[model samples]
Target: MNKKYQVFISSTYDDLKEEREQVIKAVLEMGHIPVGMEMFSAGDEEQWKLIARQIEQTDYYVIIVGHRYGSETEDGISYTEKEYDYASSLGVPTLGFVISDDASWPSSRIDKSDKKLKKLEAFKSKVKSKLVHFWESKDDLHGKVSISLMKTMNLNPRIGWVRATDAPTTEATQELVRLSAENSTLRKKIEGFKTIEQPDEEKRLVHILDDNTRKFKVRRKSDKGRWDDAEKVRNTLLEIFLMIAPTLVNESSSKTIAKEIAFEHVGNNWFRTWPIGDNKIKGMIADLVALDLVQPSKKKHSVNDKEEYWSLTKLGNSILKRARRIQLEEGIDTLEDKSEEDF
Candidate 1:
């Protein structure tokens, strides 16, 4: 009987980082899942498809419009507005929060370009056309979001997700059990007769070298004791997988994975500094997901631990075992930076 709704938080990044964090915290405090594009750009068709799919899956959509209009696509529409339009088209129960016009805000956070400012004004107008809340500060936004969401959910209840164990065992479930038993019998009759082959695309993913490598940028301290310019670092999927596989032997939070990677590459002192941004770390994890190596962990955690968790998939574990075997055969004791040819 426990159901959790998923709420999508859409807004411009960097400028609204604190606001988004507060919103996510508020959603989690309400005991629902909060999903967003914190790690994605939503610029390309493929990215748009992913965003659309996520929006479709969410029970409610929350858009926070601040000063910045956000990065635009080729059509000159900001991705934030694009997301709002798509969510509206689907009639997803929406909650809009716009920064109060009279509120004092950081100049750095405001749009500098005349074009972006125009777009921001238009976007705010479009959002204000609907029932929306105005907030002057992050705390104000958090409080309003919590109260508004509770009321909206009461007025517009949604069929959300529940744990498998929580699902009612009804006649359909009994039918499924019967069908599963019949399927098991059928499988026994044809065991080993035909090998199940992976899809060509998935099989190709295993051999594609380009797909196996990802680049991450990190900022290191310069000789003058100041942060130097960011530099690119590339790692093969196998290398990255091995780097974090130990920590992920169990379900580990994304923050934990980032810490492990940072400590391994940088040092413990700088790991806390997070030489690489969280989004870039998530990009690394996303790559593993594309390779079907890891998946989001569904295990319950305390609400205080807001970070998303991940676990190694069965295929990932198999690959890890194989890699260990190869290491043993090659007398490799520890993971070391190797050329692309090594992978």
Candidate 2:
């Protein structure tokens, strides 16, 4: 919808009449309403109140300066400056323009009194130091006002006046507020759902590897014993799993542990002494996770952290009761309880 603003013009009336006229024309061309001291009763007893009321009703304020400082209010500041100050205090969006210092003005348009000249210079300094345009003529000011007002309106729009019938109903506004609150609540609830302890494929893995190298390898019973003592190492590997299953219960963590296993040097042993490298370790943990004997811990683990930890699942715990005793009879023990001294 097209919105029209009411612009309150503030400047010395007699001196910058042509400048003010140009501004008013520009404002009118843009379909905005213009009101100024020229349209009001100048010397009325309640002039300040009237100006305050005008500023209250205005959607914007435009202050321009020339050579002269016009009539002053009881506070000794010019009424034009007073209007600008009042509009500013009320938080009205303001556009200011001033005559360039190099521009020549007729003596009739300037204040000859020393005090008034000082005030005029101070006022011009105040206005020109901020969001102000310096214009040499009415034509320059007209173009400046047109561009400034249009840009200002687009950037800092205000809550403008509307017809009584055009305003939103009280119930409709209340409904809008309620819906806004509900939208916020629903967003928070969705965030909570995302954080719940449920598996998410899209979520990043804690130990993500760019190189998909499958280093860990597990021994299989079905494999033929092509190498020396292959059968013995395979059985020992099973005992190793049963021994470490209680501590390294998660695949990601257990895959990283370097176990020091002590195995009896049996007859015709051709294999290297116990403990394996990366791929063999990972394969062992992978089989455990697949068998539901080991579970990935819910505790947050970082690859940089020493993440060699896990827990036995319910089935693993049940199997452990008997597996521990059987593994002891078969001469298997965790490195945590045994060292080179135990051998």
The global C-alpha lDDT for each of the candidates, from Candidate 1 onward, is 0.77, 0.65
User: Which candidate should be chosen as best, given lDDT against the real structure?
Assistant: 1
List model 2 lDDT by residue over 243-291, tens digit each. 4543433322443233322122221121222234445666756766665
Tens digits of lDDT, candidate 1, 34-70: 9998757656657988898999998999999998998
Clashes of 1: 0
TM-score of 1: 0.50
TM-score of each: 0.50, 0.49
Best by TM-score: 1
Give me the runs in candidate 2 sitting further than 4 Å from their true place. Answer: 168-343
Model 2: residue 238 alpha-carbon error in angstroms: 66
